[model samples]
Target: MAEQIELHEQAPRLKSVSSPQDQDKGTSQQDDVDDTGITEASLTLEEQTDLDARRGQGFEAYPDGGVAAWLQVLYCFCIMFTTLGGVYSWGIFQDALHAEQLAPSSTLAFIGSTQATLEGLCAIPISALVARFGNKNVAVVGAILSGLGPILASWCTKSVAGLFVTEGFMFGAGQALCFFCAATLPSSYFSRRRNFATGLVYAGSGVGGAALSLAANGLIKSIGLPWTFRILGILFLAINLPCAYLLKPRPIISPIHHGAQGGLTWGPVVKISLLKDIRFVLVLIGSAVALFPLFVPPFFLPLFATSIGLSSGAASSLLAGFNLASATGRIGWGVMADRWFGSLNSLLLCLAANATSTLVIWPIAGRVGPLAVFAVINGFCAGGFFSLIPGVVSSLFSDDDLPVAFSMIVSLWAPGDFLGAPIAGYLLQAFGGPDSGYEAYRPAIFYAGGLGVFSALMVFGARVKEGGSWRRRL
Candidate 1:
């Protein structure tokens, strides 16, 4: 009776688009836990309403495996391919910049770090905009900025400071908005196959990195760096805009938990109360720490390869191999998460293994063979961090809170992402820079592995908190 009354009251704000039969079917579907093992029953009544309203019809079931649903995955692939794909291939640019003696390795690293940092830093407001104006609108704006930033950066390639604003700040902001949408929207479309679908979406980064790494290297060889930036800017605009447009998410109304924004209220766009939840807090911290090591190898692999006597072309191939391995791991880990291990459990294993690969495999890998092995191992395990996080976030929150919750969680990643590569660069520079030989890179490698270990421990705690025992699938 209370639910019915609440539904009536909500009618003005959330008009039901489904017929009575459709609503009844949706209600039944909502009552049961899905294959991902998440249930609406666990949510508060308000949260439940918010979830229902977000479905557009206030009760529509997920499309699951329909054309519309799969197309979203494809769209997200393109977005990540053009945006994060390029971000992952930052080594190509860094290598070129290093050759030119533009600045210290640390300073050059800061350019990429700035872009990575903003991916987390700007997420809160962008997510709030997602909640308020809808996902498509925010993503469209991101598409524009994603392109514009690079186009602008082409003119500023001569100045590191200018690159900071264009490539670092602007590009990072655009990636954040686009990534949030890509990462979160597929969950709205899938229940049983949520992990797998998200894995497919994130795999775009690996595939894009693999392809674009080679492409960027080739472009740089053929044309000058400035022209390369111009071509990439045009590429970003052409691809990201269409994908952003075609990527339709379920309609999201004002989130009551955050309170509706009125005339210029200056609080966090999505005021998350999840901070009070210890499990969420732990997961948040773990995810942030995980970021500390996630990009280190990608950013430095080419330089590291060069130190070990590989040519520039070979270094590019190694980076591409790492990305390709990561792509495979994204899909493979997602399947494992769905079939055998739970998302949290899978994430725990991945982080631990990722750390082990970095700590154990990397230090001993002085030759091409060992280094190549480490790259593959590290890339595969590292991919799990990106793939399973959506599933983990989905497990913790109701659908209505997902966009904000995920954004808020990742926003904390700004510090880790911002510092990870720069710290590595500084470590290398402190030990005598990249010219100081392969031994100079160990400190940074240890730093990255240590952060991964810390992240794994945090994840373990969160998992224990969730299931009360390590034996459970949760």
Candidate 2:
């Protein structure tokens, strides 16, 4: 039911004046807070008009910064810690599967790639489910699948195909459900501090990844892989089930926020007209291309360390350190996005830095000292991608259009995430099998780095489309 409230006897009208540059770009700056008490700097003239029309309609205002909002952030952090944090720790399992000779390197890469791909691809349908069923209900399903998949996978360790179904498809599906629901909510909860809040949310992945990677290594050594998975399953259930219960989506009139009463209808799944916008198209392409090289390092870094004669424990430690640095990067980038460089600008800078580090550092880092340095720099740079994307999408679209726009951006990440590491694995095998020297890995590194460069260029193009001035905080 819509809340009924009395309006002030003499309600003040919010106003904004467009500058010449804003006129050229077609965006308006809200000089005064809206009825919701939020100042939206990126609102288009049409969006501003829509909000004005909604005033005095008895809609609840955005809490923006309150206990309820921060609690949601905390819940989202725990969700990411279990979902993507586990995915980021795939290097530990990759090394183990390789040792067991369970499958070819390319095939082994698929197990990780499949889960990662599904996380991206499944977001489209999950968004619909969230719209109809509500965030909490959908998140409950996610928690179940995420916990159940690994538990079942423990029984299917002998067959590579079995791992695909349990670990890859099932776990991937769960991640999509939980991750997308949590990721999309921050935009609704906060406007001024959205970037910073989102940064803190995503930083969970790095922290979880770092912690779980170390834990998995110890568990694998102490008991075994199967037992380690069972323990992880119990942990996922305990953490996520409670978080799912606490998911209190802000009451909104939009279809996606309709929860159970929304009736099987999807409001704006993709907004087909957005395909025609050059800015949207450019950012979409860049987002897709960026992932082409994103997983290459995380998937192979442990193997690379071992190839250079580091002990297994030492190699795993490097990955853990890398993830810790990634956590720092997420927070740092988020602050930068909110305080200094705007989201789009931050994304472009991060991608460029990510590509540079991969190209210049990895190939020459044959020893422990250099490899450790590469991990920290590259991990921090790569971490920015997760923290900045939502802000960039929000900047380009209206609040009503956010669900569809952000869905499209994440959905496109599937192709690159699915294929990047497998291609690298295939290249490694083609050049020479495991018996071959580290030279076998060079082609894969170059391929990943080259794609990173291309992704940065595409983002640069998007930045140009937005207005190429470096002085402007895009």
Candidate 3:
């Protein structure tokens, strides 16, 4: 009797709300409620409606393997090739600036050091800028700056100050932009294939470095530094043009009730991630420390070879081999990471290899064959470390937080880079010259290897705490 009375009373209320438009809306609401179960504690109808509005702002679907995404990847390859090629080509430039230009070795070293420092240090501000203005704008500006730096450098005289401005500051700025933009783009386009995408993008650096090595070597012999640098700059601009067009941000849907202008703040996001997440901190620290020694070999390998009685051509060849090995390593490790091991495990394996190769192989590389083998091995291991870091970082943080996370990691890396080369130089000085019959590079290698080991242990501890091997899924 009570149920019948209630139904009788509710029929008039239902009838009153049952116009054609109201009926359609009511049906949709019920469907939505069924799709995501409604509880008494759930948001009010207005709140739910607002969320639906916001969800509509997101992209309908990502073009995972679309032409645009591939083009973006290609553009990234070119950008990396130009920027990292320049970084890897530092040996040739240093020699030219010292021998042909009659600049002091220490002064030229400072130029390279400054460029390296700024490249790492600028990541924070540039990443923030990318977050605000989007990657295309940041990349275009960075590309222009990078393209123009070498062109301007071609006109510089033999002054350290000139090199500092053109090579260190300007070129450094350009490289930072290129690196950040390339790294951030594919993350927005692919989820399942992110590791592969990143590997492909980073492989660009190795390819660029290797190709530029041969070209720069011949150009230095035939045309000279000025024309060589100018030509390289033009090539860089060409590569960056396509990337500038292809890189775009993923679209985000706004909740219905809130305007697009109003969004969540960074504070709550960070607090929530940090309060509950330990992986983020661990990955960040491990990556930063592991990265400390990565650049050291590339920066000093040619010098190390030359000091060991190798000719310039032979030393350059060793550098080329290292870079080529690195290219192979990136692809191999990336594929393996995506298939067998997760990103964290891949990082651990790479770091262990780096530590082992440096500690065991490099210290004993006295003979030419041994040295060449060691160079290739070291390059491969270090390349794996580099290629795996971004994937590992992504595994720890959400997409919205990735820029800030990467920025922070890059910023922390500045000190590591600033110290790595100078410390290597100091180690060389402490050992007297290569003529002292004592290997200076041995101590430096051990130090770097030790840091790698330490980083690996940190990852291990974190993995243990998380109740899984590093190879396990996050």
**TM-score to native of every candidate shown:** 0.84, 0.84, 0.83
As for candidate 1, its clashing pairs are none
Q: Which residue pairs show backbone clashes in model 2?
A: none
Q: Candidate 1 local accuracy as lDDT? A: 0.78
User: What's model 1's TM-score?
Assistant: 0.84
Query: 335-377 in candidate 1: lDDT tens per residue?
Result: 8887778678899999999999999999888899999999999
The C-alpha local distance difference test score for the whole of candidate 3 amounts to: 0.70
Root-mean-square deviation of every model: 6.9, 7.7, 9.5
- State the TM-score for model 2: 0.84
User: How many pairs of residues in model 1 come into backbone collision?
Assistant: 0
**Which should have the higher TM-score, number 1 or number 3?**
1
The backbone clash count of each candidate, in order, is 0, 0, 7
Candidate 2 worst ten-residue window by lDDT: 1-10
Model 2: CA > 4 A from native: 1-62, 97-101, 251-264, 433-435
lDDT, candidate 2, 349-457, per-residue tens: 9999999998899989989999999899999988888888888887766555566777788898999888877788889889894457567788999999999999898
Give lDDT for model 2: 0.78
> Candidate 3, residue 347: CA error in Å?
0.5
